[model samples]
Target: MEQLSNNYGEFAHFPEKVIQFGEGNFMRGFVDWQLQQMNKQGLFNGSAVVVQPISQGLGKMLKEQDYLYTVILEGLLDGKTVNTSEIISTVNRVLNPYEEWQEYLALAEDENLEIILSNTTEAGIAYDESDALNDTPPKSFPAKLTALLYKRYQLQKPGFTIIPCELIDRNGEKLLAIIQQYAEHWDLKADFKTWLTKENTFCCSLVDRIVPGYPRDRADELNEKHGYIDNLMVKAEPFMLWVIEGPQKIKEILPLQEAGLNVIVTDDMTPYRERKVHLLNGPHTAMVPLARLAGLETVEEVMLDADFSVFVDDLFARELIPMLDLPEAELAAYAEQIKERFKNPFVRHELSSIALNSVSKFQARLLPILLRFYDTKNSLPLGITAALAALIVSYLQEAGNDDAEVLALFAEAKELPTTEQVAFLLAQTKLWGQDLTEVAPLVDTVNDLVQKIHEVGTRAVIKEIHQQAE
Candidate 1:
């Protein structure tokens, strides 16, 4: 099979206008894929120069293919399963800063450059006090970015719009803070700091997509079908959302909305973030233990069970939706989209994969909704309380076998009744950040669910509750 490149198809080489900080799978599947859409719609007429953020990455492999690869999108769209493939030609080249420091810095001098995008992971935007500006490609992502920005500052060129897609909150602001910290640490000029602060536009962004890249299981089949060998082929769900908090002027510069993509440029991303976390992430965390207890391994399998499906629907509509401040219609629409994504047959999302560190996951994703529901309605949400019970039971059932903390939590409570067990767990302020016992009847509600699950099962309990929901 031939390699994937411009030679295989009619590909236009646009001026490099995007300097991207990561060449990983998410960037390829999400950002680059959208870039391809924008280019096709003539909304964006520019290519990206992908810079490998870490010391080792797919830069060489990407360069080998001339920065061209296929993005295979397979998932549920509307009411049908859709499978589509497109060759993303938006990436012009790939550079490893570790090996090509001068070339990476030279990107700052590009007259066509207008945006600096990155997805260097959650830990990528941290301040490393030891990172020196003179290091051959500084040890940290922020340091390297600082060096690049300083180079651009020296040129007296207009500031590029810096947007980071890291999972951290306010990623753009955090990255800029680290860069500024580097400036102060290295004793860079105040004028350069002024340029960094006054000239640059740092926009925080929220990106959502599930990109399960390099389908190794079907690589050979995919290659044979396409009659081409693509080592960089990426796979993702049909759902993609990019919510950017930026200046109003950004709407004029990056007109991605013209492509009909789910891109929202807003002054505040808080509501969107809260909506996503509660509607999508909260349910994901809630489903993990309950689904696992019900003998379901994958999200699709859980959805297949009529009882579990209805339980999920009720969890969203009756429990989660009422707590959020967003409009009911919009929330319902988004919730439906989330359910469809979960039902994507091509994506085998294991319940256990989402079960990792579930204690903290619940606190971060679901607890806010739980507390808010209590505060507003003066009562606990039954579905979420049951989920809390399921989580507690699931952890205890496999206690001492996984995390040491979980093991310790169960060291002395193994022989107690479910209610007593619930009491002990709820009293651990370190876990919930407060004694959940103070929430009035929440502890009892979880205890009842736990006891009922032990007596009957998750399926039966869910079926009963789902019927009530109807």
Candidate 2:
């Protein structure tokens, strides 16, 4: 079969108006896919110039395919199985900043480059004090971005609509603050700092999609089906959402919504963020330890299990939905959507992968709801407490993946008596941001659940608690 490239068929080449960082599957499947739709519909006549954020990345592989690839979206939509594929031609080229540092910085001179998109992961947006402005591509993502923005400032080019898709809270604001710190550290003029503040529009965005990149298992079959070899083929679910918090004028800039895409350009995205974190991520975090203990490998497996599915449904409908401030009907609808997404057989979301840094995940995703549930109902949320117990037990068994300190703490806790171990884990102010033991009856309840889980196993405990709830 021929390699997937522009040589295979005629394709429109648009101006490189988007400078995107991170050329991973998520970007190609979500952002680039959306851009291709926009371009095809004549809403946006532009393509993205992808910058590989790290020294080693998919730059060479992407360039080999002429920056062209396919996105296969497969999942349940409205109770129907939908599988679709499209060749994405929205990527103009790939540039590795590590090798082409000068060329990377030169993109700042393009007046047509009005937007900047990034998904460098949560840790990608950090301030490295060691990074120097003169260094090739700098050391950190923020530093690289700072250097590029400085070049744009020098050229007096119109500032970009900088939208960061990093899964951090206030991502755009955090990124902008780091760039400001770099400006201060590098002794750039006050005027440049002012330009960074006034000229640039940083938007905090929330992106939701499950892009499992490069289907290695069925690569040969997919290649034959498409009549070409696509090294960068990404598999994702049919669902996609990009909620960008920016000024009203940004709608005129990107016009993503105008293209009939599932993009929401909002003035405030706090509610949307809450919806995703609590309804979607909260259950995901809560279920990982329990599901893994129940001998489940993937999310679909967990959803297929009779007991686990009911447990998940109860956790969402009974515990999580009531804690949210959104409309009850809307939250209920979203909960159903999340359940369907979890049941998607095409996406093999592993429990072990979600288990990483679960302590922090619980603290961020479920802890708030746990606290609110207790406050509102004056009783422990059984499912969340059960989940907490499972988390503690997972750590004790060394089944958790977390920071060295967290692991060490749990390792030490494992040597203590059961009650003391539970109490000790709960009292760690660093883990849950406060001594969770101090909450009335929380420690005793979690201890009971933890003991029950150990005696009966996760599935039995889940079944018992689910029956009690029903």
Candidate 3:
């Protein structure tokens, strides 16, 4: 079999217009895949120059394959299973800044470079006070970006449409702030700071896709199937969404929507963020404890069981969706998509993995909806309340994964009376951001649910909730 490379077939070369940080599976499968779609449609006639964000990366392997790889998308689409593969050639080259610092900095001088994309993980966006501007390639992603931005500023080049795909809230804004801090710390001048702020468009983006990179398990079979030894083949889910919180002008620049891609360029991404949190993530967090307690190992396992499936459906239709301010139909459609994603055959999403730090997950994903549902309907959302009860019970049973402090608190709470335990957990303002006990009937409702869960098994309680909803 031929190695997956440009040598095997002719490939089009476009002007380098995007400097992407992080040459990981996610960028290749998600951002670069979308870019390839746009380029094929003549909407975005450019390729990305991938800069390895860290010292150790896939730069050598990517370069070996001529920066070409295949992305296999397997998942349900529109109520039907769709499996597709396409060779992504949107990456022009991969540069390791550690080895080729000068060449990496030279990319900043490219007159055509207009977009900056990154997914350096959530921790990659932090400010490291130790980073110096003079370093060949600064340690942190933000610092490296700051150095590159300073280089571009020196050349008086047009600033980039900086869109960071980090999972943090306000990712672009936070990246910009970190760069500005570096500017202040390094004394890069007020004029440079002005250019950084005014010339550049920092777009906070929300990206969703599951890229289980490098299918090593089936590599030999897939290599023979494709007739190519693809070292960088990435396996991803068919569903993808990129919501860029930016000005409308960015739409004209990228034009991904013209290429029939799932890209949303909005001025505010709060509603979209809320939709994802409430619909997709909230349900995942809420299901983890109950599902794990019921001996379900994976998300698909929970979704496959008839009663648990209906319980999750009602949790969405009756509880989570009503709290959102977006169009009911749009929310409903997204909820259905999430359901399909949960049941993805290719993905084995473990309940215990999702259960990690579930305290914070519950606080962020479900608490707002729980509060809003109560305020709007003037009644407790039984499904969510039950989930909360299950969470506490899981911790009490020593089945939860959380910070040591939180685990210790739950350990101590386990010895208290049922009502007192409920009250004690609810009153931990530091954990919940506010005293949940103040909400009338909340503590009592949760106490009742916890007691009921202890009496009946987790599966029985879920069946009861679904029956009541029906």
| The best candidate in terms of TM-score | 2
- The full ranking of all candidates by lDDT, starting with the best, is 2, 3, 1
lDDT tens string, model 3, 137-198? Answer: 77889998899889999998888899998766788999999999999999997889999989
The lDDT leader among the candidates is 2
The alpha-carbon deviation from the true structure for residue 188 of candidate 2, after best TM-score superposition, in angstroms, is: 3.4
Relative to the unseen true structure, what is the C-alpha lDDT of residue 135 in candidate 2, on a scale of 0 to 100?
95
Q: In candidate 1, which residue ranges exceed 4 Å CA deviation? A: 76-81, 285-297, 306-311, 349-364, 370-470
| Candidate 3 stretches greater than 4 Å from native | 76-81, 98-103, 135-137, 210-218, 285-298, 346-470
Cα error of candidate 2 at position 108, Å? 2.0
Residue-wise C-alpha lDDT for candidate 1, range 223-267, written one tens digit per residue: 998889999999889888899998888877788888898999999
Residue-pair clashes per candidate, as listed? Answer: 0, 0, 0
lDDT of 2 at 365: 82
Q: What's the distance in Å from true for residue 274, model 1? A: 2.2
RMSD of each: 5.4, 3.5, 5.1
lDDT of 2 by residue, 1-470 (tens): 88998888988889999999999878898999999999998989999999998888998988898889999989987678888889999999989999999999999989999999998865577788999999997979999999999999998888989999977678899999999999999998898999997999999998888776777778899999999999889998988899999998887878889998888988899999889988888888888899888889878898998888989989998999998889999999999888889988888777776776788778878998999998999998898899999999888887466765678888889889876998998999767879997798998999898998889999998888888887
Q: Cα deviation of 349 in candidate 2 (Å)? A: 3.6
